[model samples]
Target: MPTSLCGTWDMISNVNFEGYMRALGISACLRKIALKLKLRKVIEQQGDQYLVKTLSTFKNYTISFKIDQEFGEFTKGLDNRHIKSTVTWQGSKLTCEQTGEKKSRGWAHWVEDDKLHLELYCEGEVCKQVFKRNE
Candidate 1:
């Protein structure tokens, strides 16, 4: 049987996000706020469809997409830019690619040891985050 990733996950730790924002050319002031943000991710997955929301006091981002389908995405509140986003599954892991002005911008999602792992990347920096499944 395949692993099921359907649940709410609360952010527990963020690693190397400062450099990730810096690589994305985020302003210093905004980077400071973004770095300190207590981000919460609520993910609803049914088969190959997904609705993921990233919430925070400073900004919120939501994405709705299907596996293996490429769609246009506008990053509202954060960056406020548009990009072509595509998500796919490599085994049980979910990988995404966002093609836009920024180089090598994308994210990946997977489960490890009952924890949700997210890796957000842009430019040359990668931000790793771990979240625990909310009961």
Candidate 2:
């Protein structure tokens, strides 16, 4: 088993996020606002269960799930969409697949060199976000 990625992470970089949001049908105004806001991720993991929280000055998104279990998920403050989501471990990476209106929508999270990395993808557009662990 891989080491737990359970901790607070402060965003260091978010690249191609606007295009990824656009691919998800987000409005121009929301995308513009999202670009300026700072984001943080808090992850709590116990065995196969996980609680992931995304927080920012403008909005917050939270989800809880178990590895390899599929559940209904609402994007809520992020995309405002309903999808069946499942997360599984691919080697050391935590990968998620979302089934909804969009095509090829998903994200993967991994830790490298004490940094948390995330890649969010939708409709061929990918957004890469890197976060530094908060000590």
Candidate 3:
């Protein structure tokens, strides 16, 4: 296996995020605010559970669960919706499937070339984000 995906990562690039936000039904004003904020991902693992936090100056969101176990998730600061989320390892990629009001919603995280890569998708829209490990 590659290095553990447990560390602090600061985003260096974000692409097509606006389209993804629009797919999530986020308001234009909120999308604009979200677009301006730099995002950070803090990943941790304890025993059989994993915690992934999306952090920003304005807001933070966290989700914790064990692989293959389905759980309920509330996107409190983002889209403000309840969803069923399940995370599983597909090869080196840790992927999540979110079943909610939106169609084709999910995200994947993996390490490539020593950098962290994230892909967020909703309703046929995809947002790709890349982050470097925080030193």
Best by TM-score: 3
Clashing pairs in 2: none
lDDT of each: 0.88, 0.94, 0.95
How far residue 107's Cα lies from its native spot in candidate 3, in Å, is: 0.4
Q: Which stretches of candidate 3 lie over 4 Å from their true place?
A: none
Q: Where does candidate 1 stray beyond 4 Å?
A: none
Better of 1 and 3 by lDDT: 3
Better lDDT candidate (1, 2)? 2
- Pairs that collide in candidate 1 are none
Enumerate clash totals for all models, in the order shown.
Answer: 0, 0, 0
Put down candidate 2 lDDT per residue, 34-117, tens digits, no spaces. 999889999997777799999999999999999999999999877899999999999999999999999999999999988999
Global local distance difference test of model 3: 0.95
Candidate 2 regions with alpha-carbon error over 4 angstroms: none
